[model samples]
Structure formats: C-alpha cells, structure tokens
Target: MTRILIVGGGYVGMNVALRLQRRLRHHAEITILDADSYMTYQPFLPEAAAGNLEPRHLVVPLRQVLHRCRMLNGWVVGVDSERRTVRFRPHQGEGYDLPYDLLVYAPGSVSRLLPVPGLAECGIGFKTVEEAIHLRNHVLAQLDLASSTRDEAIRRRALTFVFVGAGFAGVEALAELEDMAKDACRYFPAVDAADMRWILVEATGRILPEVGPEMGAWTLEQLRRRGIDVRLDTRVRSAENGRVVLDDGDEFDTDTLVWTAGVRPHPLVRATDLPRDDKDRVKVTPHLTVVGRPEVFAAGDSAAVPDLTRPGELCAPNAQHAVRQARTIADNIVARLRGRPLREYRHAYAGSVASLGLHKGVAQVYGVKLRGPLAWLTHRSYHLTRIPTVNRKVRVLVDWTLALFFPRDIVSLGALAEPRKEFEFAAGAPDGAKTGTQDGTETTVPRPAGARF
Candidate 1:
C-alpha cells in the first residue's frame, strides 16, 4: 500500500489531506503530523482577540475532521528525504519515524522577527491562536491595571498600545482591540476611551500595500478619523524597558507591543536537502513538485512555486492561493500515482478584504473598492465561506449573535497562559519549585535573598 505523509495542518495541509482522501480511496494510507492537534483558521484571529469570536471555535480538531487519515499530534523534528523517512516527536510520547512513498511539505510560515532590542521578550506576534488569546488577555489586563492604579503616568503607559506592522494582521488586530477597549470603558469609569492610545507604525509609505494605493489611503483616513495614530515611512529604533523609540523621533512608554511585521517559512524547511529560493522557501516547479525530487511536493507559505500566470512572480502566501494550490497538488499527486499528466498550479490574484471593526472595513474585490459597512459585510461573508468546517462556521455565527445581545467580555485571563507563575512568586521560588506535602499541609520552599522570581 502507498503511504502519504503530510507535514503541517494549516489551510493547505488540511485541504490537500481532505482532497486526497476523497480522491485516493483506501489504496493509500494518509497520515498528517502537525505540531498542534487543531487546525486554526487564521483569518478569524483578529476577531477572536476582540471577543467577537470564541477562541475555541476558531480551531478545528484534526481527529474529528480527518477521521479516515491517521493523525499524529507532534512536531516534525527532521526529514531524511534520501531515506524517504520523516522523524517526529509526539506531543506526549517518544520520537518515532514514518516511511512515506510520497511526501507533502506544508509546514507553513513562522513569525518573521528582526533584531530589534527587547522585541523577543516584550513583543507578541499575531499568528497562532495562543498569541491571539494572550494579546486579548494582556490588553484587557492592562486596562484592569490602569483602572486600579492611582499614578497617572503608570495608567497612561498601561493604556498605550503600539503595533509595529500596518498590514492586514496588525491593522485589523489594532482596530478590533481598540474598538473592544472603547466599549469596555463603559464599565470602568476611571479609564476613559480618550485616555487610551493606539498607534500603528509601518516602514512603508502606506499600509495594506497588497491592496491598491487608493484603498490603502482610504484605510489610513478611516483609521485616523477613529483617532488611531497611523505613522507611515517610520521604523522602530528600540523598545527596550517599555520605552518605544521610533526612527521618526517619537518616543513613548507603552507596555503593550505587537509585532505583525511579516512571516517567513518555518525553519524546518531548511533542514531538508531540497533546493530553496532566495527567501529560504523550498523551490518547486509549476506543478508544485520540488525541483529534482519527483516524490516530494510542497505548497502554501513554505514553497516557492512558480506563478506561470505572471511568468516572473512567485505565488503569494495567502489563504486564497494556498487553498487553490492544494487542489492542484492533490490532483497532481493522484495523476502521478496513476501515470497521468500532472497539472501546473496557477491562479490570478483576487481582491483583499480588511475588517476595521464590527461595522467598519475596507475591501477591494474584482477591481471594485468598498468601505464601511459594505466592506465589513464582505469581509465577514468571505471568511465565513472560507472557514473549513460547517460546525465551526455555525459556532462562529453563534458567537457573533451573542455579541449582539451582550457587551464584549473584556475580562483578562492572563493567568491561564501561566497559571503557576503567581504561586511560584508568592512562595519565593522560581518555576519548577519543590513543594512538600505532609498530612495534607503544603510547605513552600524559600529562595535566596538576592534571587529573582
């Protein structure tokens, strides 16, 4: 029996896996190994952060969806293409190896980080569901801390939020969170909406650069009208010790810093001996087959597939392209198995949609520009249709319905991410501290006088 192994479970991975199962029957054994057990619909992350959608509903469980395929929840630590074997470390089990007749490499992208000072420790990237939830909690927690503090400077610092990217992720995250914070002000009398500041810093001259210049300018105008500080052609010099110093000479103290600047292919792609492009993405032919390796295929953000439609351009790393490319990849795989001609992957670029908030957004679809409620509706409709599972789609709709009848839940659950930190700090010990139990009495360990928590 032929064995097929797929890495990563994002849009491309899941889509291709489903397509293969539907096309290949039981002749091939399909196995998908992802670092996370659930597939996150990344487009809904901004809304998840704003409490407009439940975080749990944003993820589709692989076990439930891919029932026919063997699902291993683990990280692919190494891939030996010559041996036709892939090694992975399961979430709670020992390392194992799986031999594959054909391999599909789709380990999606990671946060593209720069060498900015203090960014590693203080910055949050808007990619994973964990990051989105952490950001939502952190922002609401800052409001809580601000309301409880009597120091004006401390309150102001807590209320200031800085986003380093003006692209779709950064802009939508900022807009939704800002709207949530403003609505949350009704409950906290001490913290006024005017007291909060939301700033977006982009290195380029305009944001949403994927969209045309006119729509980008219109987005800028809308954001500015909402009192958001949109700084263009600006860069961050440093953000050390809660002090954000911009290249444009503006300096401020802000506790919240989000870095959605960009994304690069996962580092695991480099481990393979396959050919790669200048950006470190695996180089693949128009048929989405890795160069010089007919048994290996790659797609989504990790593969640099040739865009035959444009002749010189590479496929963009967006859901629209990824979803479409998955179909071609599945078809090509079946073709190769059956000794038939494979089809090349090609698709024209569709327009973009960006949600500013609940009733505010900008969209450019098929050369038509739209803004305000129309754009917002388009944004919702497009994502609604794109989300993988019908169960998740209905749950997300219910979440939206609940939001209409009730105020957004602004309570922060920061401790959920690090629940033991507070206990360790109070016990005067570091993480992995020793605790003694005698007759149900808990004894805490004491730390050295100069030791930090």
Candidate 2:
C-alpha cells in the first residue's frame, strides 16, 4: 500500500485528506500532521472576540471530522524533499523522520511582523483563537479596572483601545471589539460609553482596500459616525510602555493594541527542498503540483499558484481561493496516482464582503453593492455556508439563535486561562505561601514586594 503524508491540516490539508480518501482507490495510508488538533474557521474570529460566537464552535476537531485518516498533532519542523523524508517534532516527545511515497505540503501562513520598537512586547496579533479570546478577556478586564480606578489618567488609558491596520482582519476585529466593549458598559454602573475611545490607525490611505474606493469611503464614514477615530495615511511608529506614537506626531496612551497588519507564508516552505518563489511561497504549476516534482503537491496560503486566467497575477491568499485550490490539488493528486491527466485550476475573482458590527456591513457580490442590515445578513449567510462541518454549523446556528433572546455572553471567564486558579486559592495555603493542590497541578508564584496579580 502507498503511504501519503499531508502536512499542516488547515483548510487545505483537511480538504485534501478527505477528498483523496474518496477519490483514490490505490489503498494508501493517509496521515495528517498539524500543530493543533482542530481547524479554525478564521472568518468567525471577530465574532468570537466580540462574544457574539463561542470560540470553541469556530474549530473543527480533526479526529472527529477525519476519523478514517490518521491525525497526528505535531509540528513539521523540516522537510527533506530530495530524501523523501519529513522531520516532525512531536508535541510531547522527541522529533523523528517520517518517510512518504507522496507529500502534500499545505502549511499555511503566520502573522507578518515588522521591526517596530516594543511591538513584540505590546502588540497582539489578531490571528488565532487564543489571541481573540485573550482580546475579549483583556478588554473586559480593562473595563473592570477602569471602573474601579479613581485616578483619571489610569482610567483614561484603560478605556482606550487602538488597532493598527485597516484590512479585513484589523477593521472587523476593531469594529467588533468596539461594539462589544460599548455594549458591555451597561453592566458597569461607573463606566460610561463616553469614556471609551476606539481608534483605528491605517497605514494606507483607506481601510478595506479589497473593496472598491467608494465602499472604503462609505466604511470610513460609518466608522466615523460611530465616533471611532479613523487615522488615514498614518503609521504606528512605536507602542512603547502603552504609549502609541504615530508618524503624524499624534500620541496617546492605550491599554489594548491589536496588530492585524497581514500575514506571510509559514517558514516550512523554506525548510523544504522544493522550489519556491521570491515571495517565499512554494512554486506550484497551474495544476497545484510543485514545479519539476510530480510526487510533491502544494496549495493554500503557502503555495504561489499562477492565475491562468489572468496574466501576471497570482491567486490571492484568502479562504475563498484556499478552499478551491485545496479541492483542485486533491483532484490533481488522485489523477497523478492513477496515471490520469491532471486538471488545471482556473478561478475568477469574486467580490468581497465584510461586517462592521451587528446589523451593519458592506458587500460587493457579483458587481452588486449592498450595505446596512441586508449586507450584514449576506455576510453571515455566506460564511455560514462556507464554514466546514454540519456539526459546527448547527452548534453555531444554536449560538446565533440563543443570542436573539438572551443578551450576548459578555462576561469574561479570565480564569479559563489558568483552569486551576480557583483550585489553588481553595487549597488553603497558610500566609499565602507555596502549596500544592490535591491533583498536584498547582504552581506557586511568590508575591513580589508590593506587586499585585
């Protein structure tokens, strides 16, 4: 039996494994390696951050979804394409080499970071579920601190939120966070909506550059109407010590700084011996096969697939293109195994849609422009149909249904970070000294001279 190895189980890896299972009858053992056991639906991240959707519902468990395929939760550290061996670093143990007859390289992208000072310490990227959940919890905690503080400067800083970048991830995350934080103010008697400050600093001249200029202008107007400060043609120079310094000479103190600038392909591309483009993307033909290597296939954010329909253009790295490319790659791979001619992937660019907040959005679908509640409904409907798994769809639909009656789940369960915190507190450590829980999972953090948690 042939052994096929699929690396990085994101949208591409998951789709390839499932499609190959049905298409190929060559009796191959398919194994998938990924850092996380679940695949995250990134479009729902903003809603998850704003407490509109539960974070858990955004992830599809690989073991449950791909029960027939062997799923391994580990990191693919390096790939020796020439030797047909992949170096995998297991999550809980030593690293090992896995040899395969055919390799599907689909590891995706990572947060594209810049060399701005203090960014590593202060900035949070809006890329993962952990970051989204932390943003929600940290924002709610900030409100709690602001309401409890008597000092004006500290209160002002705590209530201030700054987001750098104006693309979909940045804009959607900022808008959703601002909406949720403002709505959460109702619960804090001491906190007023007026005290909150939401600022969006865009390096470009306009936000949502994917949408046309007119739509971008309209989005700017809508954000301005919501009292959000939109700084255009601006750059965030430094975020040192909670102080945001901009190129326009404007500076402000903000507790939260979200950096959603963009993403670059994952480093695994360079780790392999396969040929890559100047942009560090795996160079693949129009059929999703790595150039000059028939046994190796690539797709999704990590692969630079030439746009056959449009000259001098590469496929944009987005969910729309990623899913289609994954499906095409799977089909082409099966064709290669069965000695059939490969099919070329040629897709036309579709319009984009984005949500501002609840009951508000902008959409340009098939040359038709829409805004307000209708656009918002369209945005939800489109993503609802695209997100994988009927189990997740039903769970998310239930979450949406529950939201119509009860209020949003704004309460921040900060203790979720340290699940054993309450257990530690209840263990009765005399004089707050070091002590262990009954389960032996507690770690004692000695209190500094006058420090507070």
Candidate 3:
C-alpha cells in the first residue's frame, strides 16, 4: 500500500486528509501528523474570545474527524523530501524518522514578529485559543483592577488597552472584546465604559486592507465614531516597561498590549530543504506541487500557490482559498491514482465580510455592498455555512440564537488560568483559614489591588 503522510492539522491538511480517506480507501494508507489534536476554526476565534461562542465548539478533534486515517499527535521537525523521510517528535515520545511514498506538507503560519525590544517578554499575540482565553481573562481582570483601585496611576494604566494591527484578526478581536467590556461594565458598579481606553495603532494608512478602500474608510470612521482611538500612519517604537511609545512621539502607559501584527510561514518551513519564495513560503506550482518535486504537495499559508485567476498573483492566505485548494488537491489525488490528468486550480476573487461587534458589520459580497445589522447577519450566515461539522454548526447557531434573548456573557472565569490556585491555597491554609492569597505568586490575570469585601 502507498503510505501517504500529511503534515499540519489546519484547514488545508485536515480537509484534504478527510476527503482523501473516503476517495482512496483500500488503495492507500493515510497518516496525519500535527502538533495539536484539534483543528481550530479560525473564523470563529473572535466570537470565541468575546464569549459569544464556546471555545470547544470552534475546534474539531482530528481523531474524531479523521477516523479512517491514522493520527499522530506530533511536531514535524524536518522533511527530507529527496529521501521521502519525515523526522518528527511525537508528543511525549522519542524523535524518529518515518518513511513515506507521498508527502502532503500543509504546515501553517506563525505570528510574524519583529525584533522590537521587550515585545517578546510583554506583548501577546491573538492567534491561538490559549491567547484568546488569556486576553479575555486579562481584559476582565484589568477592569476589576480599575474598578477597585484607589491609585489613579494604576487605574489609568489598567483601563488602557492597546492593539498593534488593523487586519481582520486585530479588528474583530478588538471590536468583540470592546463590546464585551462595554456590556460587562454594567455589572461593575465602579467601572464605566468611558473609563476604558481602546487604542488601535496601525502603521499603515488604513485598516481592513482585504476590504476595498471605500469600505476600509467606512470601517475607520465607524471605529472613531465608537470612541476608538484609531491612530493611522503610526508605528510602535517600543512597548518596553509598560510604556507604549509610538513613532509620532506619543507615549502612554498601558498594562494590556496585544500584538496581532500578522503571521509568516511556519518556522519549520525554514528548517526544511525546500525552495521557498522571497516571503519564505514554499514555492509551489499552480497545481499546488512543490517545484521540481512532483510527489510532494503543499497549500495554505505555508505554500505560495500561483493564482491562475489573477496573473502574477499568489493566492491569499485565507480560509476561502485554503478550503477550496484542499478540495481541489483531494480530487486531483484521486485522479492521479486512476491515471487521469491533473487539473489546474483557479478561482475568482470573492468579496470580504467583517463583523464590527454585536449587530454591526460591513461586507462586499459578489459586488453587493452591505453595512450595519444586515451586513452583520450576512457575516454570521456566511460563516455559519462554512465553519465545518454539523455538531459545531448546530452549536454555533444555537449560541447566536440564544444571544438574541439573553445579553452577552461577559463574566470572566479568570481562575481558568490558575485552576490549582484554590487547591494549592487550601493545602497551605493558615491557622484561621483566611480567604486571601497567602502566597505572593502573581498570576497571569492579576486581580484588583484592594480589599475584596
């Protein structure tokens, strides 16, 4: 049997593997290797972070989905394509090399970080589930601190939130969190929505570049109208020492610094001996085949797949392209198995959709522009159709339906970060067993610096 090895569990790899399993069953053995057991539906990450949807619903377990295929929870360290061998380290296992007949490399991107001083130590990226959860917890905790604090400096710093990106991820993240914070403020007697400072610093001239320039301008206006400090043509000089200093010489003290700048191809790509583009993405032909290597295939954020629809343009690293490419590749793989000719990939540009918070959005679909609540509905409806899995789809839809009746859930379960804190404290209870932190261990989500009672 031909042993086919697939890497990465993102939209491209997982989608392709699942489809290929049904088509090429009894002909080939499909094995998938990924660092995470679950594939995150990144489109729903903003809603997940905003507490609009449960985090569990946004991720599909690879084992459950890829039932027929063998699953390996591991990291692909390097790929020796010439030798047809994969060197990887499985979770809690010794590093080993696995030989394969065909390879599907779909390793996705990582946070594109710059060499900014103190950024590595202080800044947080809004990419993964963990980061989203941490951000939600941290934001709420900051609110708690601001509300309970008597110190003016601490209160000011606690309320100031800064995000350094204006792309889809950054905008949605900031918007959703802002909406949640605004709603959550009602519960805090001392906290007002106005007290919170939301600063969106973009080095570029505008936000939401994926959307047209007109829509982008409208987004900027909407943001400013909603009281967000939209700093355009401004770059971050330093975020060192809780000081958010910009290129324009403006500085502010903020406790929260979110770095959603962008993402680059996976670091593992660099470690492998593959011909890469100037952007470090694997150079793949229009068929999503790595140059000079017919057996090896790649797609998604890791590969620079030529866009046949737009001359001289590479396919954008988006969910739409990733899913479509995976399906095309899967079909082509079956064709190859049957000694049929391969097909070229091509797709016209689809419009973009963005949610600007609860009941607010902007979208341009098939040349039809929509704004406000209508656009928001389209955004939700479009994504609901594409988020994958009947179970997840039902769950997500239910969440949205429930939101109409009940207000947004803004209560932060900050203890989720330090689950053992209470247990650890119980083990070291004092003579009187006071309900207070005995240890000086600072948690990732620090509470208000005042009396609880």
Candidate 4:
C-alpha cells in the first residue's frame, strides 16, 4: 500500500483526507499531520466569539471525521521533497522523520503580522476556536472590569475596543462582539452602550473587498450608523502599552486590540524543498500538483494555484477557494495512484457573505446583492452547509434556534485560560516552582501573575 502523508489538517487537509479515505480506502495508507486535533470552520468564528454559537461546535475533530486515516498531532517543521521525508515536531516531544510516497501540502496560513510596536504582546488574532473563545471571554471580562472600576481612565480604557484591519475577519468579529457587548450592557447598571468606544481602523480605503466596493461602502455606512468609529485610509503606527497610535495623528488607550490584519503562507512552506512563487507559496499547476514534482501536491492558502477563470491571476487565499480546491486535490491524488488522467481544478469565484451582528448582514452572490435580515439569514444558511459533519451542523442550527428565544451567553470564563493559577497559590507553590508528577517527574510550570485580559 502507498503511504500518503498530508500536512496541516485544516480546511484543505481535512477535506482531502476525507475524500481520499472514501475513494482510495484500503488501497493506500493516509496520515495527516496537524498542530491541532480538530479542524476549525473559520467562517463561524465571529459568531462563536459573540456567543451566538458555541466555540466547541465550530471545530470538527480530525480523528472523528477522518477515521480511516491516521492522525498525528504535530507541526511540520521541515519537508525534504527530494528525500520524500517530512520533519514533524509534536507539542511536547522531539522531532521525527516520516517517509511518504505522495505528499499533500496544505499547512494553511498564519496571521500576517506587521512590525507594529507592542502588537506581539498586546494584539490577538482571530483564527482558531481557542482564539475565538479567548476573545469572547476577554471582551466580556473587559466589560466586567469597566463596570466595577471607579477610576475614570481605567474604565475608559477597558471599555474602548480597537480592531485593526477591515477584512471579513476584522469587520465581522468587531461587529458581532460590539453587538454582544452592547446587549450585555443591559445587565450592567454602571455601564451604558454610549459609554463604550468601538473603533475600526483600516489601512485600506475600503472594507470587505471580497463583497465589492458598493457592498463594502454600504457596510461602512451601516457600521457608522451603529456609532462605530470607522477610520479609513489609516494605519496603526504603534500599540505600545495599550496606547494605540495611528498614522493619522490620532491616539487612544484601549484594553482590547484585535489584529485580523490578514495572513501569510505558513512558514512550513518556506521550510520545504518545494518550488515556491515570489509570494513564498508553493507553485502549483491547475491540477493541484506541485510544479516539477508529480508526487507532491499542494492547495489551499499554501499553494499559489493559477486562476483558470481569469488569466494571469492566482486564486485568492480564502475559504471559498480552499474548500473547492480540496475536492480537486483528492481527485487528482487518486488519479495519480491509479495511473488515470487527473482532473484540473477550475471554479469561478463565488461571492461572499458577511454577518454584522444579529439580523443584519451583507452578501453578494453571482452579482445578486442582499442586505439586512435576508443577508444575515443567507450568511447563516451558507455557513451551515459548509462547517462539516451532520452532528456539528445540527448543533449549530440548534444554537441559532435557541438564540431566538434565550439571550446570548455573556459570561466570561477568562479564568479557564489559567485554571491552575488559583490552585497553585492555594497549594503554596511559588510561581515557576517545580512540581512532582505521579511518576516522580519534576516539571516547572510557571504560574501567571494575573489575568492578561
């Protein structure tokens, strides 16, 4: 049996595994290597952050979905395509080499962080389920702190939320969270909706470039109508010590800073002995095969796939392309194994849908525009079909159904991030002190000084 090694169990990786398992079955041995055991449906992240849907429901367990394929929880540190060996490093173990007859490189993209000051320390990225949940807890915690604090400066800072980047992630995340925060204020007597400051800073002149300028402008108008300070054609010069300094000579203190600035190809791509384009993405033909390497295939955000619909353009690194590319990848891989003619991936760009809080959204599909409740419903209905697994789909639908009756869950479980802190202090174990395990192994786990949120 042929050993097929797949890197990054994300949208492309997980889907490819699922398709291959059904197609190739016992004919080939498939192994997926990923940092996380679950695949996150990123479209639902904003809703998850807003407590509209449970974060746990947004992720599909790789092991559960890809039962036939072997699952390895690790990061691909390096890949030697010439040797057909991949170097993988687990969360708590040493590195190892894995040999494979065929390679599927779909490690996905990481947050494309700029060299802005204090960003690494202060800003949070909205990508994974963990980040989404953390952001929700953190945002709610900020509201809690602001309501309780008597200091005007601290209260002001805590209530002020600043989101950088006006892409789908940034805009939707801010919109949903803002709506949740505003609704949450009804319970806090000390805080009002007007007291809190919500600001959106975009480097580009437009927002939601996926939905076109008209919809983007309309979104801008809608956001501005909601009293959100939408600053266009501006950049974040610095975010030092919770103080945000913008290029347009404006500065403000904010306890919350979300950086959804966009993404770059995962560093693992650069570490591979693969043909990379100028953008550092694996150069691939329309068949999803890596350039000059028949045994190696790449797709999703990591592959610079040529756009057949448009001449001289690469497919945009988005979920729309990634999910469809997955189908072609699986088909091509099976064809390669069976000595059959492989099919080329050719799909025209489908328009985008963006939810702006409950009962409000904007969508552009096949040049047909939709807004308000219709668009919001479209956004939910579209993602509902895409998130994977009937179990997850039903659960998410139930969540939305429940939301129509009950209020949104605004409780902050920030302490969950540092569950051991209180216990360690109670046990009289000093911060960074070594603790003995059941097998008499000593490990030093550093106790957090306080809640970072």
lDDT of each: 0.90, 0.88, 0.87, 0.92
Using lDDT as the measure, name the better of candidate 1 and candidate 2: 1
TM-score for each of the candidates = 0.93, 0.93, 0.94, 0.94
lDDT of 3 at 322: 94
Whose lDDT is greatest here? Answer: 4
Model 1 alpha-carbon drift over 4 Å, by segment: 92-94, 421-453
Candidate 1, TM-score vs. the true structure? Answer: 0.93
TM-score of 2: 0.93
Could you give candidate 3's per-residue lDDT for residues 376-443 as a string of tens digits? 99999999999878988999989888988998776767777777766565455533244445596533
Ranking by lDDT: 4, 1, 2, 3
Provide the clashing-pair count of each candidate structure. 0, 0, 0, 0
Candidate 4 local lDDT, 1-453, one digit each (tens): 999999989889999999999999899999999988999999999999999998889999999989999999878899898899999998897999999999999999999999999999999999888898999999899888988989999999999999999999999999999999999999999999999899999998999999999999999999999999999999999999989999999999998999999899998888888999887899999899999998998999989999999989999999999989999999988888878999989999889999999999999999999999999999999999998999999999999999999999888999898888876665676444667889989887565535332
**Predicted candidate 2 versus true structure: per-residue lDDT over 1-453, tens digit per residue:** 778999988899998887888766458889999989989999999999998898999999988888778988888988887889999998899999999999999999998888888888988998899999999998998998899889999999999999988999999999888888888989999999888989999888889987888898999999999999999999889888989899999998988999988899998788788898898999998888899887888988899999987988999898888889889988887777788899999998788999898888998888888999998999999999988989999989999889899887777666577776555654555546566679987778564322334
Lowest-sum lDDT 10-residue window in model 1: 444-453
Model 4 weakest lDDT span, ten residues long: 444-453
lDDT (Cα) of model 2: 0.88
* Model 3 weakest lDDT span, ten residues long: 444-453
What's the lDDT for candidate 4? 0.92
Candidate 1 lDDT, 331-402, residue by residue in tens: 999999999999888788889999998899999998999999999999999999889889998998999888
